[model samples]
Target chain A: MTKENNKVTVSRRSVLKGAAATTGAALGAGALGGFPTIWAQNIKNVTLRQFGTGVSNLNDVATKVKEDLGFTLKMTALDSDSVAQRAATQPKSFDIADIEYWICKKVWGAGNLQAMDTSKIKNYDKIAGTFRSGKLTPESEIAQGTAPHTVGFVEGPGSKKFADNESGWMTLIPTIYNADTLGIRPDLIKRPITSWTELLNPEFKGKASILDIPSIGIMDAAMVVEAMGEITYGDKGNMTKEEIDKTIAIFIEAKKAGQFRAFWKTFDESINLMASGEVVIQSMWSPAITAVRSKGIPCVYQPLKEGYRSWGGGLGLSANLSGLELEAAYEYINWYLSGWVGGYLMRQGYYSAVPETSKKFMTEDEWGYWFEGKAAKGEIKTPTGKVLEKAGAVRDGGSFYERMGAVACWNSVMDENKHMVRKWNELIAA
Target chain B: MNNTISPEKTSWMLVSPLAFILGLFLVLPILIIIMVSFWDYNEYNFFPAFISENYDYLLTSKVTLDTYLKTFKFMILVWFFCTFIGFTVAYFLAFHVRTLPMQIALFLLCTIPFWTSNIIRMISWIPFLGRNGIANSTLISAGIIDQPLEWLLFSDFAVVLAFVHLFSLFMVVPVFNTMMRIDKSLIEAARDAGASGFQILTNVIIPLSKPGIMIGSIFVVTLVMGDFITVRFMSGGQSTSVGRVISNEIGLLQYPAAAASAVVLLITVLIMITIMMRFVDIRKEL
Candidate 1:
């Protein structure tokens, strides 16, 4: 296996060298009109390998890039955990690492990715203020936990440490994000559910679920615990060792009492649990709720009193990416934030970083329905043109501002992450 | 120069390819895991260092003991069901079936479900055993039970059910091979000596089938102990196994801890196999 990996690496290097020589010769023979045509021809040979979680590493986006930029965009979609593992461990395997903000906290220390220059990101000034200043509006209190802007910027291009405020250099160019909440099967429950505390209500015993991911799951647990009046954490995002212990203990007791039906780790599992009526209420992503509803089920991404636990994801260039490849990666990021890809992702219940740019690509009805909290003027459709909601249907949890503004916390990597993971394993074992 | 190679040299030559393959793939990987198990790790990276903390924590933690016990429970339960069902099926095929072609055809029929992916077969059980699934709906319609049985799915029962469904074939193939080789003359002699059919089965056939049973037991035991996905899926992430513990750690990028857990599991599995080997001389039987 090692021998084969080495051989592939060597052949790729030789290919890159050959491409560089050809580009150099083309430059040497350049004339004003012919140079632009030669450059376009050579760009067709460029292939940028990108990888991320299944949420946004899409084939449609790759196809669009191929059509518009005349370059190959090879995309690999892994689970969130695997995406982090690959980004931190295999620096040379990919050109772009599209990952979550919490994952950036983990991968940034490894220095596998180069800090992106904000000036080159055509729409950087137009990005959502939530990703730049950790607030929806200037008056909005920054949510607790690892908010995107905290780790989004660095001191300079060569810096590894995260800067306190926005610098010219960025760790990741913000792309897509969403405010997450509990999804409930209202037909089965037949009651008003409006709080995170509802997750642990014994009345819903054997019908409640949470994701099994340790870092994110712990934050969800903290929200439930705080709402239930069990413990008040200083920062739910960065829990102390004692805070972690108490939070896990509460969940373990609930588990023993059979309060949980199951803990899901993937998007489809959440949809399956809700669709099958196996789980009545659970912490769920926005898209999973949409998926359950699309299957003709009555599922709600319930707005809780305690607020949503939000996360953001973005594209980061690999440190190994340089020269033509680096320029192409920058071009891809600029295109991503420009309009079409943003609009495509926004249609799937996620908010694009540059909502203004996405608005241009979407119809007025689509914009009003998805982002302005208005009832659909007509039938709303997914990016694939499948009917999502009928006329008179409004998006769950209301408009983008209301949902993103009410975010109580962001998904975080705690200071005591190791202890939390160990305790989490114990919770599973128990 | 001598044109002919010596016997010992020829024997070494014959074994060299297999040795090289094992060394590169198996032995080297095991050695790396062992080395990594003793190293130190933080959140983002594992570094080379002589540290016992990973092992110390694993050996002393109550969770580790509980996970091991849970894994063992699964192993023993799955082993019992697989062995009993496997032996009965093999016995019927060997003694009751009259024609070789019929026996071969029946054996091939047993493998029909194996054509699809293992994950597909395991997941197919969800719709059958879920709250509103076929089993519960059927029970409700017949007035057999008013409420759905919650334990039918996402329980220890489901985990064991999937395991037995997936791995019984492993037991069937080996047991059937040995059952086919059992001497007919021995059964004839037992009958002539006034032994009943039950006595013939107990005295003549079972003793001869020990080797196959041992081999099958090994297969079932190791597979159950090493499995994480089946337990994770069938139990709906409500249950834990030794493999799951290691995998969870790996997911968190805690490699040294995961390696330590893996090393302990490997040792435990090895000890179990060694204990089983003592009950039967497998090489002589084969």
Candidate 2:
């Protein structure tokens, strides 16, 4: 039972004794919020918990609406999982949450959120039903407990699209989306490493990086394993144990060969690894490419012959609520899906479902660089003063967010995540 | 029974808060975690039932023990280094830094890190040793190194560096207090009785400072024993620490396995504390 010094105690959750010092501090501060007793008399408070891309902009818009639109909007910010976890536990923690779309079905299964009433927000109707699509078709035998409709969009690996028809081709709304590309340094190899095969190249030893998160990373590993015919994982969104083992073997073999420079836990680290040439190419997201391009480095997002993996994040509401709070929540959710918030996230190195609103905010040339995939029309330098003439995704299905409508991976649950993660660990530790 | 002298009944009220906290926060959850470790893991990261397989895999696997051994070895190395350095710094502050104001300032400086969140302090270390960090810039500017050191920020060395930085204060407070309370006249008497300054320090000061040294050691050992964040952050998730293992388990919602690791760590720390109490009462020593 004895273990090493670096063991993590139960500190993250219940291990936090002393009554959660941070929670206490927040409560203490909330006490002094100059909390208008008079204001409390007139206005009701609503909280919306969300994470990452949409947090700040959504908060700002919420504040604007509170001031001008006259709704006392109370918002709490948290990670993607926390949003779902809280809704599962204390149903009254928030009225709305910008949850990751894939998690929505999971939460709905746990009896967390109520079905989104479309009558509250007519805007939900005017927009494409693609945002409201679910993975199970209208006729699928997903126990009656599941939420039959999709609430909004989050970006992920691209797939097919269907109209009004509810099927596996359905997608949630376009949240902030981007492609997971192999960001490679041109100086490393004469020939571009555009395929998964390049990672197994003996020529470039100890010059790779991979994500440490097993969920997404294992999928990438399985993709490579299948491409190499070493493993075939993801059985209709469920990976068998054998398939997982094969993927693990491939990753383990790669590790033993000293193929990786290091592994990155965060988006920032991957960018730093790429920029310094420590890792020539690793599993990287669009933000990292945007960062490297800013540095005047010649790092290119090599559109693989196979395909770049993609991901997205967006919002939902607590199921327990309906009435006016629900209406206010729907407003916030739609505003998030609407141009203002989505557009802001898009221009800041993210692609939006509401591309039109985001483009309206961007300069004509900026729009061309991101969505149109055109080179800089005029002499322009990236945020880091790097000349990005042939800068953006050179491949046709670029702008990882916009194209996610065809992405089958968005919010789709793998049948066997445990086996998938176990396989992932085997791959990394191998 | 003499109420004041009886061990169990005398201080039950004094110990109630801790007992309650442990029962509610630590012991009870640990029990649940033990139950969870034997359950199944889903893609959504849920624990379903008692599927002896998770424990079966855990018990039968050699990698688990290997990771455990590496964690203990890391704790030993980290505890030794931090305690040694901590004793030295605390010694200088107590005996040498005679001015009260300066001592107060130094004490405050040691605690400055505590004022900020732990995460900020850990993250700040990254920039100092990162690819574009000061160490790399200074070396490159001095024409000492051409390329940024890939291993500088997320290596074993980096893990140790971060641990020492975080834990040194735990060492300093007790050692400094122990040194301050020593009879000043004992050193004077030793010097008067034909003893040199070094001998006086060695004979009187060193022996007297044991209480502080032991107390400080307990703090450092326990803290380093349980912390995984510094190592996890510094090593870029390559290295295994008991904390990392437990954290990964928790992330996958494997509560019982994580709990098992935690229980192991807690028991080890409690044993160390008990051993230290024999040399001197930690309460009086502090």
Candidate 3:
């Protein structure tokens, strides 16, 4: 019996030694932990590459949504245009991506995303009907989202830049969307500046800034051209190839005029340019408008008789990202569109896709001020008790939350993307 | 007779550990990277099958070649400038300096850039090259220029400046070491024989320092060839480089194309190093 025990002990000791040897080798190798390099071979987990700005804050939002459930969301930030291109070519790179409504139709046609799975989302039933089946919203639906829609104007010397009536599928969901209006420092370029012609006024020479971005920026220029009525693109969102050429010509003229003090790439750069007082008037975005207001500077979104144009962005799912992960992705999307999170996004200066969840969170006085455009009804506090003001409240698309979903634009590739980027470069150079 | 080991056997045994390490770390991964580059990236941007698409694009595309040309040009320019400046400074320290401590201090000064991280050193250049930077401010205040120059921070010249600042030390260390080894009697004898100072410096000092120059050139060229961050940060996306192109492809999750581009770069750098070795023995010099 003692001999048998000794033999058994030797076998056990050998097993322990083998285990330790393998573990030690792995530790010494500095083996990559849980690296999904192997996942490239495996088809189970889909990869997602999202391209945009504000990764720091978006990472926080992604964490909150992922932690609320057990889904793992692998997000990589990129340029908005680059995201559209990847979605255009490698549809499988991302199972889910956030794109602007302006680029929706073409991207969808490119087979980048699989559209609405209403079944996967249960609480989606709670969303307003206007957002479903596309457009046709009641006047009451205007203030339904988490944040009230604020009017944004086209490229002003000091104004915010918004996607106006220029064609292409609306790639953005239009959360923080603004209309094409003129923004001016009441201290510099005083009021009664109601039309597109004023943007070309020589008095503001070298004191204006415009977005250097080609696609949407051209659209804003087209709107101004349309407001002028002599130069025409013949369509709002739908333009022919010839129409695109004419629009480029009009933009080239402006570029040669040296009317702009600078062409900006980032939102912060625009702010810095404006703050330098070098640019007293320029096309701007909602956040910039809010920033100017917060500093107690007098800035106003000029109302135009011609309807202001706008653009938006929305969330979509991947075809391969089905089952629990897909369901989770949709849940996160629904929660985002469900008003609460949308309101939080809006309180920070954006429009919400869902208005109901955001509405309940808003006080009656707060609602009146933002929707009615009267005065500060009260110190509007968020769920976290943060104070925010309701400015840029007079949004033109009362049904903007619902009506903008018909948004879709096809992205051009190969020779076409080259042409677009080139045209933009020439426009800046000119 | 069998009790004593053969010299050949002893040598093999001694070299086996080094052979094993090189094979495992360098040879194996390189082979894998090359193999993977030839594969197709699937729905998840994962390598799955033997694919020609990645290579087809990288090899044939205009954008790829443009980036390669830009990268090569930048490498050559940076190498030439860095080597020239480094040799001058190193020559002064080695020949002109009177004290050994002073020489050591100057050598340490050459290495001061290494004391901090490469990234921090590069980024510190931004404040000095920005729109309202010190140079511009000084120029403006001194009435040398009217407005702030927007081209300073993000330009090809700026990229070169950063590259030289970062890498000049590689050239300095090798050249300085080479300069120190020259016999004083040889120089005196050359002078006594009526050889001019410039001639002696060129014929004796330069020819003798060929090995050191080769070693330093290889180091600087190889490093600058692989660098993308300095170009990317300095150029602000105005131009493209090989490393930047690879980084962009990686960002888009196009790993196969990125890997293929890396393979191409690896081959180019290898060819360069091989050419350098043909002229002089780098191993002996180092």
Work out how many backbone clashes candidate 3 has.
53
Error of 3 at A236 (Å): 12
Report the TM-score of the second chain of model 2 against its true counterpart.
Answer: 0.81
Candidate 1: global Cα-lDDT?
Answer: 0.91
- What's the ranking of the predictions by lDDT, best on top? 1, 2, 3
For model 2, residues A1-430, the per-residue Cα lDDT tens digits are 2352123232212323232344355468776454333234223333334333223334566666666435545556643334445544556565555555555544544444444444444345434323454332344222111122432321221321223333322233345655455677877666757577677666767677777766567656655666676664444234677766666777778777777767776667788788866678778776577677777777776767655455555554555554334555666556655565555554445666556656665667767766766665664444334555544434334643334433333323455665665555444333
User: Which tens-of-lDDT digit does each residue in B109-220 have in candidate 2?
Assistant: 8897799887788778777887778899999999999987766776777877788777888878887888889888888899889999889878988788888778777777
Using TM-score as the yardstick, the better of models 1 and 3 is: 1
Docking outcome class, model 3: incorrect
Query: What TM-score does structure 3 among the candidates reach?
Result: 0.62
Q: Order the candidates by DockQ, highest first — what do you get? A: 1, 2, 3
Q: Which is the winner by lDDT between candidate 2 and candidate 3?
A: 2
The lDDT values for all models are 0.91, 0.60, 0.59
Q: Which prediction has the highest TM-score against the true structure?
A: 1
What is the per-residue lDDT of model 1 for residues B36-75, given as tens digits with 9 covering 90 to 100? 9999987678899999999999999999999999999999
